[model samples]
Target chain A: MQALSFEQAPPPSVPIRFFLTAPLFMLLAGLLLLIDGEAVMASRWTPAALALTHLMTAGFMLQVMLGALFQLMPVAAGANLWRPSVLALPVHLLSAIGAVLLVAAFHHQIAWAYQLAVVAIGCSVLAFVPAGMLALSRPPGTSHSLIALRIALLAFFATVLAGATMALARAGLIDTGWLRFSSSHVALGLAGWGCVLVAAVGYLVVPMFQLTPAYPRWFARSFAPLMVLAIGLGMVVLHPTAWLPLIGLVALFASVTLDRQQRRRRAKLDATFRFWRFAMGCVLFACAGSVLMIFNIGGNAVALAVGVLAILGGFVSVISGMLYKIVPFILWLYLQPRVQGVPPMTRMLNEQWVLWHLRAHVAMIGAALLATLWWPAVYLVGSLMVVSAALLGGQLLRVVGRARAALRLAQPS
Target chain B: MTDRLPPIVVDARRLLPPEPMERTLEALDEMQPGQEVLLMIPRQPAPLFDMLHNNGYAYTVESQPDGVFHITIRQASGD
Candidate 1:
């Protein structure tokens, strides 16, 4: 067993910085949707649509995922990072700036922007992947979460490399047929990196937060490797039907999560619990959409629906839910000993605001799915998205503000 | 003749996160000198160990067969 090093936990600012900044990207995505609603909703390949997608994925998702890893690796996995506070600065800055540049490159098709974005994001990943790998290499024990985390990191690396190759090709820097691997890039990113990482964290947090029983040992141990294998087979086969196994695997994960959640020990159905349930339902819906793709059922409209369900409906909802629990708990943990009257973690944030955000988010997802079918609904989707992002950002700031107030009160005159 | 108080037992195996840590700290705060506490939790309380060490307490952790962790903690002799 690895000795736990809670002492090595980075100062709260490390993760909190990333958390606080993440929502701005989501807000940016909302603004982009408002500005180019018609073109963005028309098809996935449109410049505005590409910008909108990256703003959510690379901008918002990457920030929170990296931040969570900085905290989670040490506490849960006993994989202490080397000076995490120092490491977080460059990673956060490059990631945020690179994401912006990438969105600009896609939206404007600016050649120089593509080159700069590729370099900036490439360096950010380079800095993070090695540090993460080194920490994960000799974790205290080989828990299933740690095993999945290791694979997820490798997948993240491959995803970034693939993205860089495609970006370079787009900039006319090289023409090695890298664009043909678009599906592979998406597979590695969403499944290999995104879903696997979620699985890794889910194994740890679902039981901890929801008071659910642990995932079955066999499922936890095998899920990440199996996901990677399916993604690999999909890449090699280069056929639409090859995605069936991957889709089945994702559906299995979603169904299993829903099953476990049904038996939660906790009596209260908090926002976080509800968000997870909603996200899982979206995942199942997205799986159905993917199956439609295999059979050429709805064309690009089906593809758009799948994207909406998977990214905005599923990942965004889940990430927002996790932030509610994580940010409050982190703040409470920081203040408990120092502040004379620190609030409980649950009370650290305004629950009314959280509920409002949840409602807005749900409506936003519904609007987005509808917009995929009827493009005019994109305006309502954009508005709800803005409202949702604002509420989430406002609540996070309120928690930080509370922490600051308590700290000030504890100070000696 | 010397009389020693038995260690206080705080069973936190059924509780979640901060509750276990909170209860343990409360027990520690109320402890008499020379008394110890046995905290039973579902998982290794790594963060609590740091808190205890920083606050001049010593602890030993043993894993139980049923998957609970038994952490024995006491104030250091000098403190």
Candidate 2:
């Protein structure tokens, strides 16, 4: 008696497609929140800000971050992802449902949205922590970006907890700022998860595709946590009321160094570089403004605006721009060849198409910063964000479509 | 003539650079003429072969039921 066995077939790039599109969805969410910019900025309509903002942070940003980790960690740690296919559905559903409900509650005046957000974000965080740890558990391969991500994941979890705390507090569950946990959450989220992770990814991806050398190892390693430590001390030490200023200085230095390195890179010197410049300038100017504020130079609101603008407009812009290249590259590698493979992911998609998105993201970043200063620019910035997200999302969906086609051809009926 | 060919079987999966197989093929492009290469890949690596072929590389794809994909390359003599 003989038995026949069937072979399992896999599609390479569907997850990458999701990673690329989810951010576009988030960008659109940010644009919607900006529709009522001044009020949201002033906290008059916190719901709009919280909802729209988290969509960017959680929906747009974290979505890609988590997806990329899944893809990259396997390579970086020299270990296969545990439960790779099995993990996607639950992770995606919980995160999506949780993010949307959380945002809707905040934006639409539903009190439960806060509760929903906590549950969803908490679950997503739970899923992400294990996955991230597992990915990093393998030996740190030579990729500086993965090493940075390994360190940044710790900060990412901190922000997630802070976010959960803020949600609970808003729901009237617990009291005490927990060391101004709300603000701490934003700092950790922006710098720790968003900034550090993006930087880590940037460190590797920039050089890999662009033919640039890695940034000085010690400098990149020291940069994030130094600012993070300063911030933590400022919050806890009380003796270091001056530490906030110190943190700003460190952040400024990091930005300037990154700007210098990007310029020195020998890659295509394309729109990606220009976007990097825009983001660096925004952060540098804001940090300088914050230092002036420390000396009691500017009005409190204006100073706050400068800092916030830097985080949202500058940092986020740089991230969005980087994604224009990165998402496509990943998709092309994972998905494009199925559509086209001898070229495989290498030249699966048009580099020129990616450049168009980079240009648009840069334009949107500038518009977003201008909107931060002027009220009317809000509508224009919002529209630009919407457009950018649309282009990016559409591109990703196309990759998924291609992946499906490749699977069919490969599966052999 | 095909039956006379020696089975090309080299476990090249580990040797392939740490990227999608297609990009790894770029390294192969630099191979010297007359280099006879045997690649053993996970069935997953079939996509890499499809791509190399699409790029106009001369290759023969044969599947063994044990799930080891055998891809043999005849070196391109620069014309």
Candidate 3:
């Protein structure tokens, strides 16, 4: 049997930096939506809309995903990253800067912004991809989550490369045809990188968090790889309906997840459970919209609504839900030994704040979906976005503050 | 060489992470010839088993009905 080390979790600071920084980007995106509401709702190709979309996807969603990947890779797969804090700091900084510059480049069409974004994001990919792959390469066992993580990382690399190419094209350093790859790029980023990682982590956390039955072994093993193959073939075939099956797969996973929540051993419902269930429902609704769009039944507005559902409703919902649980858990885990009388993990954050955030988040998703059809609804969307981000960021910051206070009390003066 | 030696007992069920595994490894390091270490834990220490086996130790695990795991580790005979 191969030797494995599961005792290699990095210091809390490593992932915490990414988590604390993520919501600020969402807040920035919200501010942009407020200022450029009309322009953003006009069309997906509009510069404002493009910038806002990337802010959510690359800025907010990608930040959370990077943090979670570093934390999850070790525990879930026995794949410890070498010198995680050292490797993660520069990557996090560059990725955050890159996400901002990328959005600015889209908004202003500035060549310098695009060039800076290319360098910054490119360097981030350069640092993260090899480190991530190296971790996955040495897993002691071939668990489904491990396989899914491997696929997600590979997809992430491809997504970064494609995105960099498109940025260069926008900068006029390359020809116009790179825009043609946008559909395939979205497929790789959202469906490939986004879906696979969520599915993999969901399989691990859903059971642990809720004390529910494990996802069926065969389905867990097969779903992600099959989705990757489907996305790849869709790109190659360029068939109009080729991507439907991939969407269906995601919808199927969502159903399984919601079902698992219903059967949870712990009857007391928390804010996280509500967030996850809402996210899964949004995924199913998004799949229905996608099927309609694929069949040419709706206009560009319907298409835009589908993207909103996937990003905000599905990804943001789940990620925020997880932060409520994960942030407190990490603080408790690290602080327990140092502090003489640390609070229970459950007491780390007020449940009221999470409930408020969830309410705002649900409203934001609904308003964003409506705004796709009626441009005036952008006001509601933007306001809710601001409220939701503030609620999340403030809660997380308070947890960190409390942990710091506890640590200070633990110290001998 | 055949004299009976008492096994070192380490109860890890009440201890949290790193401490539980750390003390077990410490016991294993101090083990002398023909001596064994017995550990009581809430869950099977899966990672430690691989490390012990790879480092030329033999181990046995017995899971009790109450969900406690009793694990014994010794240097492989003749090592």
lDDT of 3: 0.85
User: For residues A1-413, could you state the per-residue lDDT of candidate 3 as single tens digits?
Assistant: 11223356678898899999999989998999899999998988999999999999989998999998888888678788889989999889999999999999999999999999989989998999899999999966788888999999999999988888888999999997997888888989988999899988888777655546568777897999899888987788878698877887888889989888877656677788889999999999899998998899889898889888888999999999989887776676577546766765666789998999999999899899889889999988999999999999999999999998899889958
Instruction: List, residue by residue over B1-79, the lDDT tens digit for candidate 3.
Output: 6686899999876553335556787797787788889998766665566557667888888988865779988888743
TM-score of each: 0.92, 0.74, 0.85
Alpha-carbon deviation at A21 in model 2, angstroms: 4.1
Give, for candidate 1 chain A, the lowest lDDT window spanning 10 residues. Answer: A1-10
Q: Please, what are the lDDT tens digits per residue for candidate 2 over residues A1-413?
A: 00001011213342563476475555657567456666555542367666667777777767767666665555433445567677766676777777777777667766577788888878877876777677676654545555667667888888878877777777767874653675567667776667677666665555444334445667665666675666576557654245465446446555644655554524436555666666676776776666665567755455545645565556666665565555545445554444434234434345566567766666765665555566566666677677767766666666556556666776667
The window of 10 residues in a row where model 3 chain A has the poorest summed lDDT is: A1-10
- Please report the TM-score between candidate 1 and the true structure: 0.92
- State the displacement of the C-alpha of residue A22, model 1, in Å, after optimal TM-score superposition: 0.7
DockQ of each: 0.37, 0.08, 0.09
Which candidate number has the best DockQ? 1
* lDDT of residue A149 for candidate 3: 94
User: Which of the CAPRI classes, incorrect, acceptable, medium or high, describes model 2?
Assistant: incorrect
lDDT of each: 0.87, 0.59, 0.85
Model 2 chain A weakest lDDT span, ten residues long: A1-10
